[model samples]
Structures are given as structure tokens and as C-alpha cells.
Target: MSITLFRTLEMLRHVPREPRKITTSELRDRLAAANFDVTLRTIQRDLQKLSTVFPLISDERDHVFGWSWSRDAQVETLPGMDAATAITFAMAEEYLRDMLPSGVLELLAPHFDQARRVLDATDNGLNTWKRKVRVLPRSQPLIAPDVDPEIAQSVYDALLNDRRLKAVYRPRGREPREYDLSPQGLAFRDAVTYLVASHRDYDNVLMFALHRFLHADVTDEPARHLPGFDFDEWVQRGGFDADRHGEAIQLVAQFDMAVGDHLHETPIADDQHLARTDDDRLELIANVKDTHQLRWWLRGFGPDVEVIEPAEIRDWLIEGARQQISRYADASSGR
Candidate 1:
């Protein structure tokens, strides 16, 4: 290859090697940050053409299409990155990228470059171990929602520096209003990002969507804090899944053989018990915290599980089914 073509290939190789799933916009921005000066159009074209030769694949799974490599293609390539640090960043970026500080990707450009080299190494080591790993949510994968970058950046900046933000928050189905909020943290749940913040005068916390901010301005004053702010504690007790824990309830259900077998492999709770029924179905009884997640879990096994006790939960499910039936009552049936 010509010297310039060789350089192009060398740079492009790092993308699949770091094993990042990045959009064309992200790739172009990263290339620009690294001084490549490649245009977005050219980069898109290059990815398209290179896919025919390399293991590269374009994933349109979410709203933002990302270009990544086919992990199963075991082509021996060079690894130019450290095995440990690269894996940490790779996992973080993949799982929590939506919730990270807005300028993180830009700041992490150089590290990603080095990581790509290490991950691409042919040596059978931890650097290449990501190829054998996969992390997926139990819920059916939904397309990712969009967040405005500028709004997210200002929020991150204020939080990182302990400053406050003057933001316009438009809660769902409500009028847009402005408020001075002290940024606390960010939460990612079911593919959406929630900005955890508190008003200047009170210690009570409120959540605002990153995309809901029509306007944001970083203020000069330092943020005031409550006595103790533990992100995990706040999340577990009071954040997004608002009713994460409450009155514990006894849950008993009968499951079909398939759902029952899967539950045996991964019990929902430690105290769960499985007893054989006369009809060959699996009967399960467990004490679980009343939470939205539990309901969602049971819904996934629709037609395979039935609530056997706790008339309240049974009534809840029946009412839900009736509501759904009412919704479809006016609609025609599928052939």
C-alpha cells in the first residue's frame, strides 16, 4: 500500500481493535480530536468500503447507528494496549456511556487509542478477553433515547466543579419551567438518562431528563449539599425506580415448566422455594420488596405464570389485562 493509504489503514484498524461501537459522528469527532482532520462523510464512506474486507459491521440497533467489528471473526491481529485498563474503560463505555460526563469521550480519546492496540493484540490474554463477554439487560432491548449534548455538557461541568445550573426543565406532559438546580449525579435506567438534582433552597431531590433541558447555564456559586450524599444509597432508596423498596410482600406463583426451569438456574430471590404441584407445574413462594421491577419480571413470563396468592397482586394483574383488553377491543384482529 502507498504510505498515505498505509497510514489510513493503521488509523482505521484501531477502531475495531479498541472494539468500540461508535457512531460516525463520534468517530469523526474523535479523529478530529486526534488531529486526523478526516471529514465525517469520508469516514462514513471508508467504514462502508472497509466492511467488505475487514470484520467491521454497522449496527443499527439503536437510534444512533454504531460501527463495530464482528467479535466471532478470530483473525490474529496485533494488540497494542494494556490488558486491564482497556477492559475497564471498554466495559464502562459500553454499559454506562449514556450516563457518563458529557465530555468523557473527548477526554478519553488517547486512552482509547492505546486500548485499541492492546485489545487487537493476537496474544491470548485479558486484552482480547472481551471477545468472549456479553452483557444484556433482561428486558427486551429498546432503541436508545436521544439527549442534547450541549445541555448534558453544561450539567456535567457544573456537577464536576460543584457549581449550580440554571436550567429549563420540561417534565413530561407539563409546561417548561426554569429553576436553579444543584447537580448531584446522573442515573441511567432502561436506556434513559436522569439528572439527579436539588433546588437551591431545599434538600429534597428531583430528577430531570437530560433531553428535557431546553436551556442550561452553569452558575458561579458552589453547590450546597445535604449532610451525606451517597449516590448508590440515594439510587437504591429514592431515585428512578421511585418505589424501589417498600412494604415487603409474600409472592406466590405457579410457573410453566420452561419458566420454572429457568428460575431454578437463576432464582429471583435467595429465599425463593420451588415445590412440585400435582399438575406438574412449578409452585414458587418468595418474599420480595414491592417494586416495579418485580412486576416487569413477571410480565415477561406472560401466559406461563399465575399469581396464586396475595389477592392484591392478582387483582393488579387482572386489572392490567382488562385495561389492555379494553385498548384492543375496538381494533381488528390479525389474520
Candidate 2:
């Protein structure tokens, strides 16, 4: 019997028993009524298969025939995911190509293939999906640092087993630091991967870029599932306004109308608030952690973009502009 037939039997097994015992003819008619196009014999074979796994009964006195499961019985059931879920899965597959860790896709490939087969067998042709939908990753890909697969695998294993790790991390322009850390989780962000972990040396949780890791080894050290260290909360804390100093800061900036239009088209913050002034200038406010990255971004706009808030940022930009002007002054003076 087809997987669909098996699924139909499984679904029928859950339906509450009626007063009357449903006969094979009645069951066949029900299947036909639902456009199953299968015979009673096939359904009977399916029922027999289910009987081996579940508690199936036919009562002559009540003239009732149905299947039921005990409360303690572990039902090994597949998800009854609809066509929308399948389409969504297919769409997600495109993003998974580069975003997910390597080898993960291969593990899921067989399941996708099985789903396609089941969809094909349905014969109703209800699984038609738009093949035109595409996701074009940014043309200018972010510079991804080389991550050792063995180290990444080790980190993954530690997170999976709820174990600790000894990580030797080398921050940019800084000496390497070795630490014993509890592997909380791994995440992909800003076109790079990071480990959200808790260091034994530090009382607070930290985000360590995986690329910056010089070496990592799984330790027999037991992981301390700390109090109030929620992974989701920790990840959300790394949002736009999160700070390098771990303090939330407001970032405000103004741009010319033309530059404002570009910013509107491509937002810099996930939750940026944009407003248009009476003079047609665009004002943007966001919560940001690292102003250094934002400074570099605004610099690309030349004089069109201005930092309106955070006196330190404004002063830094002014000094940078002065250095640029000094360079042009010497060129113009031919001295």
C-alpha cells in the first residue's frame, strides 16, 4: 500500500468509534468518498499492518470496528504537514545551501526526496509549487574567515552533549586567550558564525566569533547550566542596539533626501525607525552596539550623511573629515 493509504488508515484510527461497527464495504465507500480510489482489500491490508503496531479491535456485539492506542503507547507517527509546509520547506532549502553547516543538508536530502515521492503519489496534483521563487544572496558577500571543520564539529558536539570546551581564541590585534567555556549555542550572524557561551573566567555570557578561534578542544569538564542564562534571551541581546560595552545605546543619524531614499531602500537596522523632516531630510534612529561599523557605513555616504546624536561619534567623524580635507589641501597646493 502507498504511504498515503497508510496515512489515511492512521488518520481513521484516531476517529472516535461510532455506535455501529463499520463494515469493509462501508470503509471502502468512505475511502472512495474521500477520492482515495483504493479497494477495501488494500485498506484491510493497511488495517492489518496497523494492528501489528496499534490496538485494533472489531466487536461483533456492538457491531463496531476501529483502532485505538493505549495512553502509555508511544505512537511513532510522521507529521501531517500540509502542502504549504512542503513549499516552505523547499523555499528554506535554498537558504540552507550556504547558511547551514555543511553535511546537514545531505542528512536532510533523503527526507526531502521521500516527501517529493509521497507528494507525487497523491495523484490530485495539489502539490504544484511556484518554481520561479528565488533568493539571491547579496552580490558582495561578506568576508568569511576560514573555520576549521574539526573545531566546528567539536563545538557542535559539545553543544549537543551539553559539555564544556577549552577554547583558545585570538581576538583581532590581541594575544590569544585560553578559557574553559560552557557551550550554550552556535549562531550565524553578519555573514559569520559565533558561539554564545559562558566562560568560567568571566561571570557573564559572551559572544565569541568562531573565525577568531585559534583552537578548540572538548573537555571532560561538566557544563554548568547557569541560572537565568537563557539562550534565546542571550541571542536577542545581540540585537541592533546592543553595545560593545554591553549597555544599550541609541544611535541617531540624518541623511540628505537622496541618501535617505537609499537608506529607506536598504535598512541598516532590523528595527530602525525612519522619519522625514519638513526640509525633506531623513532622520533615522536605531539601537546599536558597535558604532565603529556604523561609522564606516556612514563614511561611505561622504558628506551626505551626518551623525546627529552621540557627541563622540559626531566628533570622530569631524576629525576624520578634517584629515581627508588636509590630504586634499596638500594635493591642491602642490606642496
Candidate 3:
């Protein structure tokens, strides 16, 4: 595609449908991010010229008005989506829609619609693929918390452009506080999304839950990065692990035959050993991380699994069982 056409197509994508709008300056900045490097006057002219051919409108009610696509515009994406691409987009739209930030999801709405159209037009077996697929949650489903779309948009923009972000964050069980964040990466864990970032000039990083952000805006200042920092390595090192103890531990446990049957095929760790015991139980030995998730998983197999080694874990389980029994007893006695 020609440079003008490419820039125009990208600009159109950035211009949200009414009643959402984008100012000329904002469009210029976004275009610059995509390496368009056009002047504000040039952006205004391009929008005015493109408006004649496309369903685009400029809101001139105010001194500094913005542009938007007409509410009913059926804009098709360039280099049309193929059947395979359509199916992939369809799957993502169905399965991962709720997990994405609202702002990001909104940006994908056009592609999702295009995917639906492409799939609908197809008369082949691929059209039925979406129906055949299934994604099941392992645990009981929890409703995803609401995240402010504007805040999410700002964070995304900042991260994409490697710019600093300013956000008003509300910590759990605490008052809201504003902070300057240098975003490193984003983590989508289960239902919640977290922004891994550093505060001000700090070298150490922290996680800010997207739902907990009251407000956010990106700044022009460049984001600071820790020297030789690797996001993947950080994840492997248990940066996001809750209630984490130092390193890996030798986990020795016993499980009832019925409960531990699946472990024979799907071991907990690479070095896991599972064998049938003389008493018809299953013995499990593995080296695993000591994390809150580990504890939760172990506790979930109540009465079906026993921690044979790791004195602290064993004692913790015993105390938890005792408390649970005591609570039931108290309830029975109307305490």
C-alpha cells in the first residue's frame, strides 16, 4: 500500500465510532507512534480529505473539536480476513473476550465483526469449527471485576509507547493514592489483570491491579527500565506468586486411590514420582515451589490427600482441618 493509504487506514482505525471522538492532536500523536510523523495541520487536512470518501465526521461544536466515524459506518479492514484468520479471531472473541481489558476489547470489536462476517460467508466445514471447540474452567467461575476503559486505554498506550503513566491506585483495604508508574509488562491471571510496573524512580517493581486503578493517564516522559531486566525470568522467579517462600521444596504426600489416579498421567512436577502404596493409597513425591497456590491446591484435596513430609505444610494442613472441624462443631452446638 502507498504511505498515504497506510497512514489513512491506521488513522481510521484509531478514530472511534460516535459518540466517542479523537482530537486532531491525539490523532497526530497516535499516528506518530505508528511512525507516520505528520504535522498537526497535515493530520487535519488528511481527516478533512478522508471524510469526503469515508463515513468520517468532525465535531466542530467546540474550539478544539475531534473526529469520529459515523455511528452506522460499516468499515471493513484492509487485506480482508481469510477463513482461517476468521476462525482464530472468532475463537478469541468468544473465549478470551471477558479476560481482556475493556479498552483493548473495544479496539478489537471491528476485527471481531469482520471475523463473524467472514465466517458467515463461508459455506465450508470451517464455519462449524467454533461450535465444536470448548473451553472449560477448572474451578468454579468467578465474575471478572470491572476495569475503567479509559484507565486501561491510558495504561496500554503508555506501555506500547514506552512512556510513563500516572494513575490513582486504590490498594486493597487502603485509601487511593496517586503514583507515577513505569510499566514493564501486563499479566492476565485468571479473571484479574495486573500491570507490573515500578513507582517513580524505584528500581524494584510492583503489581497494580487494573480493577484497582481509579484513574490513569499517560505522560510524554520516557519510561524507565531496569538494566538487564527480563520479564519472562521475573515470572519464572515467582514475581507474581502469592505467599511465596524462598525456593522449591521437596513435596511428599499421600493420596487416596480415587483422588490421585489422575496424577499418574499428569504429574505435578517434572521430577515427580507416583507409586501405589501397600495400603492401596498413592504416594506422591515432587519438588515444587512453595506458593499460596500450592497450599490452596493441597488443601482443596481435603480428606483425600495427606502431606507426609515438609513439617510446616503438614502442620498447616492439620491446623486448617482442626479449625474447619471446630467451626462445624460450633455451628452444630449453636455457638
List residue ranges in candidate 2 displaced over 4 A. 1-86, 100-130, 136-139, 143-150, 167-179, 211-221, 227-243, 246-252, 261-279, 285-300, 322-335
For all predicted structures, in order, the TM-scores are 0.65, 0.54, 0.89
Task: Candidate 1: give the clashing pairs.
Answer: 18-116, 78-120, 78-121, 79-121, 80-117, 80-118, 81-117, 81-118
Model 1 residue 33 CA deviation (Å) reads 29
Residue lDDT tens for model 1, 1-63 = 565475466456546422346678867766666667777788888889888987788878678
Best by TM-score: 3
Better of 1 and 3 by TM-score: 3
Weakest ten-residue segment in model 1 by summed lDDT = 71-80
lDDT of 2 by residue, 1-335 (tens): 87696657644643322221345665776667666677777777776776676655545565445433332233232676556555666667666666654434443454455556555655554456525676777434554556665567568768987889998998779999997999877778656777878889465777787767878887667777878778777655543235643345677988898867866778877888999988788999987754445667777778988888777778888999999999999999996
Residue 76 local lDDT, model 1: 40
Clashes of 2: 6
Worst 10 residues of 3 by lDDT: 238-247
Higher-lDDT candidate of 1 and 2? 1
State each model's CA lDDT, in order: 0.72, 0.67, 0.87
- Candidate 2, which ten residues in sequence have the lowest lDDT sum? 68-77
